[model samples]
Target: MNAPVATSLLHPEFVQRPVPEALVQALATRFGSQCSTALAVREQHGRDEGAIAAPPPSAVVFAESTQDVQDAVRLCAQHGVPVIAYGAGSSLEGHLLAVEGGISIDVSRMNRILSVNTEDLTVTVQPGITRKQLNDAIKDTGFFFPIDPGADASIGGMTSTRASGTNAVRYGTMRENVLSLEVVTANGEVIRTGNRAKKSAAGYDLTRLMVGSEGTLGIFTEITVRLYPLPEAVSAAVCSFPSIEAAVHTVIQTIQVGVPIARVELIDVNSVRMVNAYSKLSLREEPMLLMEFHGSPTGVKEQAEMVQEIAGEFGGNAFEWAERPEDRTRLFTARHNAYFAAVSSRPGCRCITTDACVPISRLADALLDCVTEADASGIPYFLVGHVGDGNFHFGYLINPDSEDERTRAEQLNQQLVQRAIALGGTCTGEHGVGIHKQGFLREEAGDGAVQMMRAIKQALDPQNILNPGKIFTLQ
Candidate 1:
């Protein structure tokens, strides 16, 4: 097949079309076989962990260094080509999709941990290093990065999406942990957005802007993030509730009472069934909440006791707490695999997974409403959530070829997003609005804010070549 097109690429056209063969020739000059004819195949370099409108780019640029990222951006700009930044491709909102058909600058090759500042409790790394790899490198030092999104996602991809997970309740999100970044602007200029200091009264928060920009703003080559000293003592628990609403409510009360939960995830009845059937874990056939606490033995003990008491008040049962390393490992591992189990529950169907976040107070109500409506609508869906942060996912399984099922799924999605917005939450918690949630962004951001964002996009990549048809429309 041929390369894809880029319409208003810096050079002003899609890559697949019959333009000058300049891009291919130039890519061959810089990064030989790393470039691809089918960006779809290269787009496969990194893809959404779950299904969600992922379109491959025209070609893949396997970059080896920060200079490689800079060189490719320059060549693409000179040729008017759209560039889609890619990492582990574990995003959910289809952030790595090159809908405008340009270059998928696959950065996984730049995998290196430059230096570890154990003194400052910070680590500097190339964007390509996965969380697992980074943690493996630093585990010996008793310093670990805590913003986990379940998958072994790349630091760059995680940073771009502002990813957070179970540890968010206690360790905070990418927003709180990222210390600095080396970004490549739309014009191929390399710049540093932040610093090593804990806090800064800088001119503007560009670091925060790039954290969740999801690659639409610029490409990150180097990432500097704050690290945490591993907790001295850790405890894990799996608490069951009569219903998801009850489990969710217990999570709220636990967080409200300042129980210091490291992780508290909601697994609805359907999710429990799927995980059991897939992983053969004979968990109770009811809504479940898997939680963990980090602190000294005395502190964790106190926290777990307080949480159990609060959960008991809300009709939560089976509050099984585990102290041994193996026991805690098994508990969280099972919880992390819940998504894959949900998808594999039904054979031969892909998962269109999406998550939304609301204010902690409104979390229980919104979740109850969405789950009930989805079940009543007879849609094939599963529910999971990091209820500690009021963020949850609805994984829908349907054949894309079947218009009827897709339509019903879309309607359910619209309803869920509307309800989340009504409850003071975002349409997407961390997945982002790549292309799937662009419309919802308007509803969430209002026309005025969207207009300003569009203007910013115009100013940065005027040709709309960076990543077309994402977050906003160009034409």
Candidate 2:
């Protein structure tokens, strides 16, 4: 296997190659109008939500079907050019950046809900279908996909990142929900990972491998994910806390005692203010916990009452419930827009978002320390988290044009990640280790573990043509 590429995340070095005339001509000939070399198109596919600079791909292939992806990958592999998969452009870790100029396979057009087996509580979809779109399609069936990553990100991207959001506390993350995947490997071979059976003593667990592979191992053409029956009674509530510590402790205690909370999100005072202004909601600007419960009416009531008592122990105020569907939508939409709300709070500023997760017992310690450090840094910031699962983020707002600010943001992120690792937590909770967390991943997983991962990459992608310069580099 190739030795681990010695590179710096701050100034990553990629093997950039010009898109060969022959390869471009071949792709254009095959895809016809679906292919593009326009600067505008290349620019869009070159970056994601992260604050990273990388060169745009030489060309883009708007793949409409699995065959299209296979055709594109096969030709790119033959030419020994990198292939970066593009989904919703919502990844926070720079997963979609075309650091090595080549062909970008835009799968957004491949979006099609192939099948919905309501009886089996599962759905198979093309890589391009967004989570919200999938839910809308299956809403009438009394079942829905629950992995919401704030962004209306494509299911394929979520699968790629192994994402989990508010609903993860109850419904689990993409790793748990995904049952099978249809992946196009680096060498242009198509393979299916698993079957529809809920449980299996499957060999190798390739589905799990590809779920969070970030398109390095393969390009996902079709994905079959588990769905859940919509809760008969749904309710949302917001509870204000006297302090961030109090709010966190309440969450810790609620989880320890088992409240069966569907979603429990924490919004620090700063985030509340930003969201209030952005979403035009009149909410108390304090450390607050936004929660949702799903169950039968009586069961939901019991869960809420149990959680209320737990929160009261930590100085939580009265629970303000959103009973109407519209009210609940407005509340959650504001929560989901936390990142945008934070950015809007400081115009001309970008955020270095941190996704640090810890053990439930250490949640309060990890979160409080990270928040305190960010506060002391004097960088304008907002904090939000799926704290129910001991996961949280601090969106440190920084001026992209200011070198000093960028350095400070990166320092803060590094410190937070190290602290999480010290506390038996991951540098990233849901956001995969794209270019952003490559260094931290090495620190957390150790050299041996990372070596095994690199070995797998080398074995599967000897040419290194699949999303090169991500996760870890091999040379």
Candidate 3:
């Protein structure tokens, strides 16, 4: 492993690459009004939900179709300009930043459901379709996509980040659900990585390679993913615990006992209080487990009983069930709004979030230590997690101008990641290694693995024009 280095949450020195005037004029002529150089548009495309600040892209290309993406990419490739793919702009890491100076290919206009193979439980969609949009389109088909990454993120962005949210413990993540992809390479050559087949002994496994590449190797145009039929019966419940340890331990036991939970999330006291104030709901102010079970009525009941018993042993409060669809929706909406609620709690603050996932057996140990440290540091923060999968996040709210706050938050984040790694886990579980987690990525993946990644990046994008200065820096 490379020697550990101090990681900073504050903005790093960004080296801007030149976008020649000739290239700008050519893009305008080719794309007509579809291309934008307006400061507002560029600014919107330049940054994401991540706290890091960087210069906006030189231009933003609003791609409406695969052909549009291809044309834009081809033009940028010819000019040797960096190309950054933009989806819903919901990235929590700096995945959407144009740190190296480039033109952003905005795929949000490409939202469309090309085909739905209900018989085969698969759907092919344009890259810009958001998870909520896709689910709304297929609601009546008796099927739904389960990879909910909290935000209504675009399918392409979700796939690129390998996102998983509350439902991931049971339904798996984008990495497991994505069946195929149509991608535009660095040179603007289009290629199909796989078919709709559920299982393939195909060579190379390129589909997996591109799924979480964070737009480094290629730009995704179309994606085909697995779908599941809606559960015949669904039940949601919440149970508060005396402490985070109790909540997390209950989850560990529940998972180890082989309960097929549909969704399980941990919300610390800080998040619960924020959600109550922001969402106008009266949830108990305690570390809690928000859980769901899906199956036949009898099966769902059995699973809930088992989980509730497990919780009882951990000193958890009685389960508050949300049996009605509306009630369940309201409950989860609050859960999904946790980040926004936390942000709103502290006005004029930016969040430096940490995504660390550990082995199930180490969940309590990994989480408690971080929680204690955060409390001791007196940093305002909120904690939430998909503990059934042993993945959680700490969003430290800090004043942007305060260098001390940023340093402290980054220190907490660095320690959290190191603990996760020491426990046989990853620095990032769902979020990709955007600029924020690059240092931790090196610590986790080691020098040899990162070098291999660099080799792949060079082989695929030799000019280093695709989302350059992300994941890892070129030596």
Model 3, 1-475: lDDT tens digits are: 1122212455467778889988889889989999999999999998899798888999999999888888888888898899999999999888989888999999999999999999999999999999999999999999999998899999999999999998999999999999999999999899999899889996999999999999999999999999999999999999999999999889999998899999999999999999999999999999999999999999999999999999999999968999999999999999999999999999999998879899989999999999999998888999999999999999999988999988899889889999999999999999889888898889998999999999999999998888888799877
Summarize candidate 1's per-residue lDDT along 1-475 as a digit string, tens digits: 2343332211323333222477878887778777666634664753666555434565788888888899989988887787888888778766776666678788998889998999999999999999999999999999899988898889998898889987888888988899899999888999998899988997998899788887888999999999889999988888888988788878888888778889988888898898888777788989999888888999999999999998898898887878899988776777788778877877777677778999999998888888888888776789988889999989888775666666677778888899999888999988777767887899999999999987887788776677666676754
Candidate 2 deviant stretches above 4 angstroms? 1-14
Residues 24-65, candidate 2: write the lDDT tens digits.
Answer: 999999999999999999999998888777888999999998
What C-alpha lDDT does candidate 2 achieve relative to the native structure? Answer: 0.90
Best by lDDT: 3
With a 3 Å backbone cut-off (N, CA, C), the pairs that clash in candidate 2 are: none
TM accuracy, model 1: 0.94
TM-score of each: 0.94, 0.98, 0.98
Give the C-alpha lDDT of model 3. Answer: 0.92
Clashing pairs in 3: none
How many residue pairs of model 2 clash at the backbone? 0
Once fitted onto the true fold, the runs of candidate 3 whose alpha carbons sit more than 4 angstroms away are 1-7
Q: State in Å the error of residue 83, model 1.
A: 0.7
CA lDDT of every candidate = 0.82, 0.90, 0.92
Reference-based lDDT, residue 348, model 1? 72
